[model samples]
Target: MNTHTRKLIKLNAREGLGVSIILVILFVFLSVSSEYFLTVENITNLLMHSVFVMLVAFGVMFVLSTGGIDLSVGSVLGLCGGVTGWLMMNGTNMWLAILAGLLLGTLIGAFNGMIITRLRISPFLATFAMLYIARGLLLLFTINEPIRNFATPEFAFLAQGYWLGIPMPVWIALAVFLICYFLFNSTSFGRFVVAVGSNQEAAHLSGISTNSIKIRVYALSGLLAASAGILLSSRLTAVQPLMGTSYELDAIAAAVIGGTSMFGGKGSVTGVAIGAIILALISNGLDLLAVNQFYRLIITGLIIIIAVGVERYTSTRAKTA
Candidate 1:
């Protein structure tokens, strides 16, 4: 391999090492502070809970890598989950309902992309509007009632089943991470995303279809969010209209903590997986410590702020160097 390729690999390795260190530090601290933190059961449960966040984080990472954001993901999750649950409760085929939910998510994402790319709407504004719209639709469909009677054994297995001694969600999460890692690291589409994020105008000048890329990214984001929703509903054996409220923040936190620049053009799928784990550890640890939910939210916010601050500092240092 060439020197440039070697240097790139080393840089990525360093970044991965940095994230690993943070994860280790957090794990050790939690284990020390809470007697039950290292228990096998707790660890298993933590991984299960984190799967949804990891999936959503992967999607958000894609949008952020393209210098865009999708604020509607959480709402889309709720809507899709609600729809799926409602359908199943009403006797629809399980696989068919799931596919319908995923399709709905993709369509919403496409709409968001179309408005932002073709109509020149800002990503934030467009997705912000979508957030409310999706939530409203969720409430309308469920009529504010949670769907609980649709938990067929096969349906519940999607989230709670075991495959070769590992939770099904863990395997699913790993598959998503691997797929996204390949897409972001080894594909021409990934290169296009980076180029567009680094400079949209320049990418457009070079004949890259920036609009199409943005649309595709957002659609992927929606699809992942829907998948998360499906798993969540399965885990709970119910789907509440407001089930995904505030989840977007967690996904964004994961992406940012994983070293995805808010300004775009920098990200790592592996780093994001680690970030999701860190967030899960924090939540799990706080619960073990009997910390108040309110305090947990405050602490999570603080962590996001600190992570963003560190990103800015590192970016500035790199620019100067």
Candidate 2:
């Protein structure tokens, strides 16, 4: 094979190895640290909890592949859930309400894309602004209180129900992962994403529609965030004004910790799945060990910092080599 193909394979191998090693280390640590961590029930519960973040991280991985960030995901999650719940409360059909919620998320993401591509706004500024706009909209709808009394038994099943004894959310997450894996590994869109991230101007000069890619990436991110919101809301049977506050942090952390480059042009669906588990394990193990819950946030921050540092170091080494 060609040098380029070999290099690409090597890169992917390194990315997977780094994160897999971390996963193994963390898994062993958690297993040894807490007896409950090794139990069937606890492991299953932990996997269930990790799937939500994994969904969001998948989208974030896509956007990050294009060297962009979507700070609006957390708010998108809340707003989408609120929209669906509000519709249900007003007698809208359950399926339609869920569809509307997904559509809203897609539109918000598309809007963020338009603003960035058409208006030439930086992704950070555009998405950060959207973060507040979406959050404000969510708060407006649930101003008096959370949206409730709308979750039908069927609706509750979206998150809580099991398929073949596996949680419904697990099935949903697995489907999403498969789709993302196919997109990232076996499609032109994925190549374009990497090319654009590697050098947008060069990609554009080569006839790539860089703007379109950015818009689509952001929109995909929004859709995944919305899916997470719907599932989370269904499980809880309510949508509060601030249902998804700061969830973006978890999403970002998962993506980065999974070996997705902060600088872009690199990401892994498998790594992201592992990263989500690692992040969840931190919170779960702490809970089991009777540590302060807030420490999870601190640990997440540290992990992100360390991950970024490692990315920078490896990138520099590759360039110098």
Candidate 3:
């Protein structure tokens, strides 16, 4: 590898090492503690089920890297999935329905961009409002009914089919991971996002079009959220209005745990992927150990705090170093 590529690998390693170690430790502990944890079936299920949050986390990572947050992704996922299912139920072509659903998500994200850029609303508030609006629209559209029995074989294959003896969701997640890794690590768009997050005013003064960057990031966030929704619609035969409720927590937790700073300017796609795996492990371990599922939420919250604190400490050390 060239010097720059080597340095990047080192940096990503440095940032992601702690979480990686944690993942290994967790994996070993769970394997020893539970007979069910290390089985091929259980392991595959854990990884497969994690694709939804993992997909959403990838989108949220870009938004977080831009020093912004998107609270609407969960709702976006629900709405988009509902839309796709509803369309298919109404006899719309599967690919066409999926396209419309994806377009809907992208538009919602673009609208988020417009509101934040034009109205000067904080990202938190803008997306928070959008969360409710999207959810409400979904409820009205579905009449709070579950959209069921719309699964076509092609649609079903995305989340349910296997290739090379591995699950399709795992493959999809891997493809997304590879694509995002390149974007975050090797592209000008990535550099611009970090620059804008590092200092919006400086980026603007440097002719970076800060607003445009923010808009695109939000749009990307929406598209990815919609992707997760589409996958969910494929996996499940039904789409409920609130099916994606609170998934933003998982997305944020994964991004933060992966060493993406909430204060912005830094991100690692590999880190986010590892973080998602860690989360999946935690939940699976809890289930295997017969722990109350509510404890999972508490554990997730604690992880977020610890991740944020670690981020702060690491940032301080870097500044001083």
lDDT of each: 0.88, 0.87, 0.89
Residue 250 of candidate 1: its Cα lDDT?
89
lDDT order, best first, reads 3, 1, 2
Candidates sorted by TM-score, best first? 1, 3, 2
Candidate maximizing lDDT: 3
Candidate 1 per-residue C-alpha lDDT over 1-321 given as tens digits, one digit per residue, 9 for 90 to 100: 698797766666666555566678878988898899898889988998889999999999999999899899999998998888899999999999999989998999999999999999999999999999999988888775668899899999999899988899999999999999999999999889989999999999999999999999999999999999988989888877789998898899898888887788988899889889888888898899999888998887776676656655654554454
Query: RMSD in Å for candidate 1, one decimal?
Result: 1.8
C-alpha TM-score for every candidate: 0.94, 0.93, 0.94
Candidate 2 at residue 320, lDDT? 57
Q: Which one wins on TM-score?
A: 1
Cα lDDT of candidate 3 equals 0.89
Error of 3 at 128 (Å): 0.8
How many residue pairs clash (N, CA or C atoms closer than 3 angstroms) in each of the candidate models, in the order given?
0, 0, 0
- Model 2 has an lDDT value of 0.87
